[model samples]
Structure formats: C-alpha cells, structure tokens
Target: MATIGTHSGAFQADEALGVWLLRQLPQYESAPLIRSRDMEKLKPLTIVIDVAGTYDHDLLRYDHHQRGFFETFDGENKAAKDGGRPDVTGPETATGEFKTKLSASGLVYKHYGREVLIRLHPSLSANPDALDWVYRKMYEDFMEAIDGNDNGIELAEAVRYKESSTLPHRVHRLNARWNAPKDGPTEDERFETASALCGAEFGEMLRYIVECELPAREIVETALRARTAVHASGRARSKRYELERRHGLPAEGLVQFVLYPDSSGMWRVQAVTVEGTAFTNRLGLLEPWRGLRDAELVARSGIDGCKFVHATGFIGGNATYDGALAMALKTIEGGSTSVELK
Candidate 1:
C-alpha cells in the first residue's frame, strides 16, 4: 500500500487539508499515513507534504518551508521548474503564478482541484468553462484564505482587528491543547480529525456551489446573452438577477447593473459590483435618486413606477418591469432624459 508522510509533531490547516486533498485521488484514497520528520522513514513514502523542505511536483513532495520557496497562484500559468517560461499549466499550481504564494494545501489544491471537483460533481466534467470557473472560484472563495493564513500572510499590511471566526481558527483549536496530558489521542490521531474537518467544510462549499450557485449562473448567463436586445448595456434587466448578496459572473468589465425579479414580485435594479470584490460597483445608480421611495423616487428619477432605492445604492426596486429597467438604463446612460425604454 502507498504511504503518505508528514512531520509527526504539531499540525496546521495546510498540511491537514493537504493530506485530505491527496486522499481525494483514487491512488491515495486508502493509502496509509506516516507522520514523522525522519527522512529515512519519509524517503520510501508515496508522498510527503508540508515537511522535508522541498516543493517538487514531479517527486510528489510538497513543502513550503524550504528557503527560496516563492510560489503563488498569480493567475498566470508558467512552467514550474524554469519559473520564467509561460505555459498552460505546470504540474504545480494551476494558476501560472499569482500574487499570493500557496501553502501545502494550496499547492495540492492548485494541482488536483479540477480533478477533485469533477469527482465531487461529475456534471462539471462536461462543461469545461464551468469547470475552469469553479477551479478559480474555489480558490477565491475558499482555498486562498487557507493558503494566505497558513503562509502567515497578513490580511492587511497592518492588523486592524483580531479575526478569530475564520476556518483557520477552527483548525488551530483542534490541536490538542499545549498543556494536555500526552495520554490523550496521539498527534497522528488528531490529524485525522483535523483533515476530516477541513474536508467536510470544503465539501460543503463545493456542494453549495454546484447545487445553488451554478444553476443561478445559467439564469445570469441567459440574461447576459440577451442584454443588447433589452438595452445596449445588458446589465439592467427585469428577469434575472439578485447578485447583491451572491456572486456575479466574471463578465470582465461590461456589466454595470442587473435588474432581476425579486421574490416579492417586484423588479430589482441591482448594481453590478466590480468582479472579485465584495461591494465596490463598476457604476452605481444616480446619487440623488437613492434613499427615495414611491412617489418621491418616481418624481426624483423621472422614471414611472419607481418604488425605492437602497441607501447604499447597491440595489433598488420598482413596482413594474419597465420601471426597474428604466432605472437601470438611466444609471448606465448617466441620467440622460433621451434614454428611454425601447
């Protein structure tokens, strides 16, 4: 049976998650684990992660502790060994080279994520675009934080506040408290628990993405394709959008607002945020029109049937489809009176 190796002492989320990610592959699914720092013992294992001070993909040894280990998921694919040669993908991180360096979990994820995702949801195999999107999405939505935190990279140049609600905190707490009797479960045993924790969380995220987010993507895509038919911007429409609390598609920089019907049967003219950002918008609705409702909003924006615009301007609602679209188009065209519903 193949054997996996890692340091035997304390464990971090990177190695815990790395161990779990490797097992997602068929070859390593049931492979035995050896937790030790002894090179003599590690030499014969099928893989070693987060230890041994080496980061060679060909050898199946992934460690980020070595000197000169500068790797990142910079969204540019490059050759691993040479680092300078650009390629579609190296055996290493799927992203050519990114601004953020990856940890053991990230390294494993970058290489084998697409495969794991396919296994988790077979339907993704048929849609290459979605597979690619999800691979990056998983990193942005989940793995990047693990990679950054494991690498000791600060969220900001200066820490503004203590953040303990993140996944890393959970993983860190799983470690047998420092003063506990050694008679408790061994480090190797606790490692299994940690890996399972990371795996379960990751699996839940993958589940939500495939089950909930992807279906919504279809609606957004259909709405996007027919945007020019509705308005030149295609961003402000009445049938498909509610991305304010969710993610919008990676539409480059074209979309500005997305008007979709809300659950209340009202049409929403939601502002499209800058891709990859939380709330910064590409363009927001007119300022004077915000915080107004009903007659005031209709009178202020000069668009009939306007209901209300959120004070933040991230979203607004209209009683009718035409009203919402008109609000969307007016924002895109800079409040020009000539811009009217076609």
Candidate 2:
C-alpha cells in the first residue's frame, strides 16, 4: 500500500489540511499516513508534505518552509496598492489577486483543487463557467484564509481584537501538550482529530460559497442591467446585495447607485465602487444631501423623505424606497450641491 509522510512530534494546520486534501485524491484515497522526520523512511513513501524541504509536483513532495519560496495566488506581490503593481497590469485588468503566501495546504490546493471541487459538487462538472468560478472563489473565500493563518499572515497590522480563534489556532491546540501523561493521545491521534477539524471547516466554507454567495450575484447583475431603464442615471432598488462576486461585470459597467433596504427597513442609496480600484466610489450621491439628517437633509436636497447622506456622499438614507431611488438618480445626474461629492 502507498504511504504519505509528514514531520512527526507536532502537526500544524497546513499539514493537517494538506493531508486531508491528499486523502481525497484517488491515488492517496486509502494510503497509509506516517508522521516522521526520518528522511530514510520518508524517501520510500509515495509522497510527503510539510516536511521533505522541497516543493516539486513531479516528485509529489510539497513544502513551503524552505528558503527562496515566495508565491501568491497568481499575483507575485505580497500586498499591492490596488491589489497589483502598476507594471503587472494595465487599464483592462478585471481580476483582483490574492496577496497571501502559500502554505503546504495552498500547495495541495493549487494542484488538485479543481478535481476536489468537481468531486464534492459533481454538478459543477456540467457547468464549466460555474466550476471555474467556484474553483477561484473557493481559494479566495476559503483556502486563502487557511494559507494566511498557517503562514502567520494577518489581515492588518493595526491594533485590534487580539484573539486565537482562527482555525490554525484551533488545530494547533489539538497538538499533544508537553505536560501530558503517558495516557495522553498520541500525535497521530491528535493529527487525525485536527484533520477532521480542517475538513469540516473547509466543507462548510465550500458549501456557503456554492449555495449562498454565487447565486446571489444574479440579483446584483439584474439590477445593474436594468440601470438604464430604471432611470437614465441607472439607480435601482434591490436587497443589500453584493456586486461582481463572480467578476461578471455587467454591460458598460456603468452602474452608479444601489438602493437597498437597511436592517432598520429604511432605504439606503449607496455609490458603487469600481472593481479593481481601492476606496473610490464610481459615482457618489448628491453633495447637498450629505452630512444632514431628517428635516435638515430634506431641506438641503429639495427632496422629501430624505434622512441623511453620508458626509463622504458615498451613501444616503431615505424613509421610503421611492425616496432612495430618487437619491440614486440625483447622484448620477451630477452637479454641485453645497458640497463636493466623492
């Protein structure tokens, strides 16, 4: 029988996830697993991961701890000002790149991810577009977090909530404690439990992306397509939906405003951000409506039912859906209104 090798003593989140991913593949489906640093033992195994000090697909040896290794999901830059360096892309670049460095889990995912997705969601095999989308989406939405956690990459360096609640932290906790008695669980036992944890989380993430996120893109797209008809300015009412989840930009890509009912049931008109750009709204709401609330907001905008427009003009609130649509429409028409809108 074939066997896989990883380092012994303690298992990590990346190796645990990598082992789980490997087990899903046919060649390794029933392969026996071994954890060891003994090169002699690892050398004869069918494959090794998170050990071996090498990353070569042909050899089936994957590890990211070695020096001179730096890779992101398609993009080489660790962090880009606009998700990419200026020279790497031009005006027509449509896709946003992931900035996290890869771990052994990422290495396994980078290779066998599509096959794994197809196996989990067999229906995806019939729809190549959806299959392709979910494949990339899974990496961005799920695997990147695993990779980031495994590599000690945090979203920001700012002082914020400091907590060890991430999956990697949870998996690390499963490792055998130093003060444990002889009756303690073996490393292999703990590793199996860690693998189960990683697998369950990965499955949950995949399900959410497939069932919830991908399908919701249609609502945003439909509203965007009806923009010209909704009004010459292209502002329409819909749920607080997301945009460009699948990167399927609507025709002309000129959607300016979205009118959605907030949690309070009050309507909010929001400016659309241009994809691949950072922090800039595609079209902001009317300047006069901003920074004023209730009666003052109505008086400033000459429109009734106005609640408030954000000081930045990126968003505004109204009492009714029709009022929200009017806010979106006025933003697209474009003119000075007491303030310079974003």
Best by TM-score: 1
In model 2, the runs with Cα more than 4 Å from the true position are: 75-99, 152-154, 157-163, 180-182, 235-256, 261-268, 271-319, 331-342
Task: Give the per-residue lDDT digits (tens) of candidate 2, residues 45-121.
Answer: 99898898887889989887765455566643232335555344321342235556788889889888988888787
lDDT of predicted model 2 = 0.75
Q: For model 1, where is the 10-residue window of minimal lDDT? A: 333-342
Q: For residues 1-342, could you state the per-residue lDDT of candidate 1 as single tens digits?
A: 988888888788888988998899888999999999999999999999898988888999989776546567654234444555433233254445356778888888978889899988999999998898788778878998998898877877776479997878888888899797979987778889999999998999998888888787787766666667887645554232333223443443266777778898999887755545566766677888868999998889999888898776778899888888888878877841211111
41, model 2: CA deviation in Å?
A: 1.6
User: lDDT (CA) for every model shown?
Assistant: 0.77, 0.75
Cα RMSD of all models vs. native, in order, equals 6.2, 6.6
lDDT of 2 at 130: 78
